[model samples]
Target chain A: MSSGKHYAKGSPKPVLPDDGQLRLFSMRFCPYAHRAHLVLKAKKVPHHTVYINLSEKPEWLVDVSPLLKVPALQLSAEKGQPSLIESLIIAEYLDEKYPQNPLLPKDPLKKAQEKILLERFSGVSSAFYKIFLQSSGLDDFSLALDIFEQELAKRGTPFFGGDKPGYVDYMIWPWLERLPLVEFALKDYKFDAKRFAKIAKLIELLKADDVVKSFYVTPEQHIEFWKSRRAGNANYDLLA
Target chain B: MSSGKHYAKGSPKPVLPDDGQLRLFSMRFCPYAHRAHLVLKAKKVPHHTVYINLSEKPEWLVDVSPLLKVPALQLSAEKGQPSLIESLIIAEYLDEKYPQNPLLPKDPLKKAQEKILLERFSGVSSAFYKIFLQSSGLDDFSLALDIFEQELAKRGTPFFGGDKPGYVDYMIWPWLERLPLVEFALKDYKFDAKRFAKIAKLIELLKADDVVKSFYVTPEQHIEFWKSRRAGNANYDLLA
Candidate 1:
């Protein structure tokens, strides 16, 4: 029973390992896992990344993560007692356990707002993905992108939480990375990149950051992978 | 900001209403609002419930809630101040502000587990609702329901948090109430009510409780509202 305030003010510094022992079981393609990667990079937290093959999931990985989801964290040498699934929760846990560079704001209201943004992003992204997968037409997809643009515009900053990237930014930025591919897919529908100028600018800013740039992949590779999947290439490794 | 623990040990008295006057702007039929209702009922907290017409949302309601979603909770009398939106966050806020009955377990691992259940339930319910709306074939619907049944069986208890209902229960139970209608919609799917005996027992137990029973509406009314929506009768209030 960890009995203390939710936000421990003036607590002793958290002891982190000198050796790189934090193993992150993640797939590069999963938006959820990408959230954890972005946060780790932003915080400068040293961790070994273990890319899992979703199809023939390793027995050891399956034993640790019952759900077999990507972005499972294993701290130290503990195998069975690994801190398991959920990207947001894992990011939050890391932020709490190692609190030097805070991902969440101190104000309760601000924290609540961060949560709302995360929820809204999750909802909007799900809808966007559904429309993208089900309908080849870009009408609904454009509307979704427009909504994202509007949301970013309202923030009036490069990131969701104004100034420095926080929890919301970590969760949202990975999904935004796939936008180039989405635009490529719907090129015939007059999908203008300028329509999401604010978002594109923000993405550029994120990619420019030394820490944020650590997770960047070429947009072409992402599109090629999806195209392969669409062509019945079941053997393709989604984790790449 | 009112700051003090909401509940004390032993007596189990409800926290007095906030000095700013807490008012809940919600629709009766919304599962999200029912989350707030459950927390209030469990804690014996009092608040005014304003039922808003979904078809013609009032300007005041829209002003308070930009998303215009039901289950928004106003902590203070001031109209323009940001109110808590989203069911899980509202429930957590209530639990944090007024610590009666301890809706969440204090341990971090257990708390994580609770969140996983909430996330799983959210995913399953959203998928089920979509399938239900599309009136997909029984085989497809059954596959979805099978997943739900499997998840529930894993719980090994009626309530989400082993024997006792907690945050996850408040988060999920409202959606579960529509199961009868869901069953009716997929009547030809060999829907086995017996497979969900645990859920059935839990529902009966919840209904037996005065607090839970207060939120119940007849299945006929629920079905009528759902059917009306399908028939393009947009004027009918689904939340009522």
Candidate 2:
């Protein structure tokens, strides 16, 4: 599954031509785009990534995405208009259209549970993102992390869905992966990464898996990107 | 459908026992709770409403609803357990168990559309709710209404779905009915209610229909209640 599109370290970037293939317009540093990438990787769905510079969005990118946000996917085939933006909607659409490894459980109750967890994650992430934006004091950061740790503690198993990584895990992991960057931003924040044992274990498990590891990037890169973003030295056009 | 339960004008209140037949702990004014109310009425599902005062939530209410919010529903028939929380989940549960006057459309795409609209309405309502809470002047209110008007304009028909009102309509209409209260609060600020023509027209259409009007209250009363709420004079608990 990984052989066809392997990127050698420092290799020339892959050209994602508009040849009616599935083209994912994304910024590598974005958690949202990373979410889409994870889903495609887990499902083994082939797609071309067009890295959009967030500071200076390309005319074609804006033309394709009304929201002009990264993680915007264009599914162009031999016929019909290319399907456009919104990450969650696109992920669900892909899950429905291509039924390889099911992301959502079949039972309605189980599916509802997954959705609830996703909603909680969204709420938690929003709070954390706000704190990150303001470079708010450590007290707020610790409080937000404590809430997340408490939520992670409620799950029966290591993963949100108990055993196999499901929709909630995919939706949530990207943000969790970016937490180190957040921690770097607020150096005074006192939350120990190990305090969230379930999350730590889940991250370890996911990183160890071959399919998951393919999409994983080091924490150092994440911290560097965010630091540059906060300094206003880096253009964030890809995320716009 | 309206026979069993009567809120007759100028009559002594009926001796409604907390025998708990079915306890719906809700704030009557909440759009989310209104969704449950519309379904219960449509199905004629008999339940006694327990208005949970949000500001000073009783101990039992907190025990029943950890979130300490209204729209919590409990079935007295089932000995003792936690009541169901979250409006959309409760609506689905009712539709599944009762199966009368199904709220959801049968077709998959149509169901998807309802869910999308419901989500959109929620997003819009959340934005407006924030503006209503934090706005010191009319500018914020006008901006929020402008966004709401644009979203309403995107709808192809009077109802979010075509002719008949469905789940999305019930989910959204209650909130729109309450918008005037926000407007009243910003009255001195010179906010223009006339600018929201489409929303006003839709509310009028909803209020005139037999099915919708069955549970509808006068706009003036709705506005008055919500205004009192903003002033912290009225108890929301009485509303459930």
Candidate achieving the largest lDDT: 1
Clashing pairs in 2: A53-A238, A54-A236, A54-A237, A54-A238, A55-A237
- Predict model 2's lDDT versus the native: 0.65
Per residue, candidate 1 scores C-alpha lDDT tens digits across A107-219 of: 55567667876776655577557645764545655566676688789878777757867677678877677776666665555436698788778787777766567777668
DockQ, model 2, C-alpha based: 0.21
* lDDT tens digits by residue: candidate 2, B139-199: 5545555654665677657765456666766777777667665665555543355887766
User: Residue A114 in candidate 1 has what lDDT?
Assistant: 74
Worst 10 residues of 1 chain A by lDDT: A1-10
Chain A agreement with the truth for model 2, given as TM-score: 0.82
Report interface Cα RMSD per prediction: 1.9, 3.7
Model 2 C-alpha lDDT per residue in residues A46-150, reported as the tens digit of each score: 877777667656655655566577777776662443545556766666676668888977554455545644655556577677768877644554555565567
TM-score of structure candidate 1:
0.74
TM values, all candidates? 0.74, 0.77
- Stretches of candidate 1 off by over 4 Å are A1-22, A44-46, A55-61, A74-83, A122-142, A146-153, A188-197, A230-240, B1-19, B75-79, B123-158, B182-194, B218-240
